[model samples]
Target chain A: SQQGEEDPQALSIQEGENATMNCSYKTSINNLQWYRQNSGRGLVHLILIRSNEREKHSGRLRVTLDTSKKSSSLLITASRAADTASYFCATAGGGGSNYKLTFGKGTLLTVNP
Target chain B: IAGITQAPTSQILAAGRRMTLRCTQDMRHNAMYWYRQDLGLGLRLIHYSNTAGTTGKGEVPDGYSVSRANTDDFPLTLASAVPSQTSVYFCASTAAGPNTGELFFGEGSRLTVL
Candidate 1:
């Protein structure tokens, strides 16, 4: 059962363009996190936005969470070809010390140089 | 820093065979999780342990079992492999606390059950 669903399933953009991906969840969550996975590699934590936080940023990655709407968005500004990869949004709802997270199918972002 | 380590980077096994995927984390995090990734299925949790000596089932616990005898190790086992069990498995860990939800992931273990 996927708690979150990423929009656009896939996105292709030219280098230096901005890429935005949206995620909607089924239930209220404690926090939402974004992770990036390069081809054939492990996932790396990007950013996390708590329910109380509307937006957060790390380097060029920005995340926004709307608890009322049960949705979140990830934005990559001034993207580069190196930024091409699969992005996933994970939600952590009330329970289990927030250790357990539900991940979405993911959005594949391709940056063509 | 070798945050998380998963054994058997890839494996191929016949249906009905028993297989276990090993996972170990050097971070000493209190929580460990096993998730399976299939095409269009995203990542589904199979099991998790909040601490050593305790384990809990997640959304997709059927056909899978896990153990956390110690804080650093969480191993997932399949009693009987099936074709549907073929997928890439990821092991992750995180510190137990409020406002700490980042999960460190392993490279992943690809299993093919035929």
Candidate 2:
């Protein structure tokens, strides 16, 4: 079973604009992480926000987690063409063991240059 | 580079044929995982090993088998391929356990069963 679900299945935006994607999970998590995958490539770790952290940032990426609501949001400020990729949200913990990372249907973000 | 490596970047096999996907990590991580990604279905865990000599089933392990004989290698095998098993398979590992750290992923193995 999938633990996380990303909203806005697909999004398109101008290169300079900001893109935001949201995710909601079914169970309590130890930490929520986001990964990016380019076409025909592997998924790369982007950022992680623990249950205790409300928000965190790395370069142009910003991630926010709300344990109470069981939701999280990823914001990419000043998006670029290189940032065009599928973004996935994964949750660790809650569904039996903390060793498994359950990923959601990703959000496809397309940045038009 | 210090990361996970997967074999046969892509492959196509006839239905009912046996196939195996190889995964190796150099980081010496204690936990390793196999996940299959399908269109619109997202990524589903196929199998995982928290440490060498121990393996566990994930959400979707019905058609797959995985073995972790050592710390650096984990291989997934399909006794008889099926059309439903066609998907992109990824191998990943985490140094401290998935819950505590980020995962390092391999490029992925694309498999097609016809």
Candidate 3:
């Protein structure tokens, strides 16, 4: 079973607008990582937030993790047409092998020009 | 740097035929993984290897087998392809230890089984 689930299966916004996606997990995790995937292509690593860190940023992306709630959110500011793609959150559990990540269903974002 | 690459961008195979999907990483990472993506179910792990000579099952491992003979290459094989196994396959790799959770993926291979 998938440990993480992203909400708002899809989202649409005009250029320059901000987009947000949420992910909720069922188990305790050591870290959560986000990835972006273009159509029919590979996934690019976006950012990773450890359980000890509450928030992080990279370029136009901002990630927040709230362990108390077992949830996390990714925000893309000043979205551009190039930001259109699918975003996924993957969680690494605490025990056993922490190398494998359980991915969420993902959220598809469309940035209209 | 060609971080990672998967062979046969796409393929068509017949049911009961054997097929192998190749994955190679130049980063010399110690971990590699194979995942299958479907329409609505999202991506599910087929198998993973933490390092050379070590392999483990992921969420969906049946019907598929993988080997990490060397640190640079991890290959997934299907003994008897089935229509249900038709899907996009992805290979990923990451450095060893705690940071292994951060994966770098390949362009993916689309397979169609008839």
Residue B47 CA displacement from its true place in model 2, Å: 0.3
Instruction: Give the per-residue Cα lDDT of candidate 3 at B54.
Output: 95
Give TM-score, chain B, model 2: 0.96
Clashes of each: 0, 0, 0
Candidate 3 residue-wise lDDT, A1-113, digit = tens? 88889989999999999999999999888899999999999888899999999999999999999999999999999999999999999998743344788888899999999
The alpha-carbon lDDT assigned to residue A45 of candidate 2 equals 95
lDDT of every model, 2 decimals? 0.91, 0.93, 0.91
TM-score of each: 0.97, 0.97, 0.97
lDDT per residue for candidate 2 within B1-114, as digits (tens), equals 759999989999999999999999998888899999999999999999888999999999998999999999999999999999999999999875435678889999999999
- Clashing pairs for model 2 are none
Pairs with steric clashes in candidate 3:
none
Q: What CAPRI-style quality would you assign to candidate 1?
A: medium
Which residue runs of candidate 3 sit more than 4 Å off their true CA positions? A94-98
DockQ scores for all the models shown?
A: 0.65, 0.61, 0.60
lDDT of 2 at A107: 99
- Give DockQ: model 1: 0.65
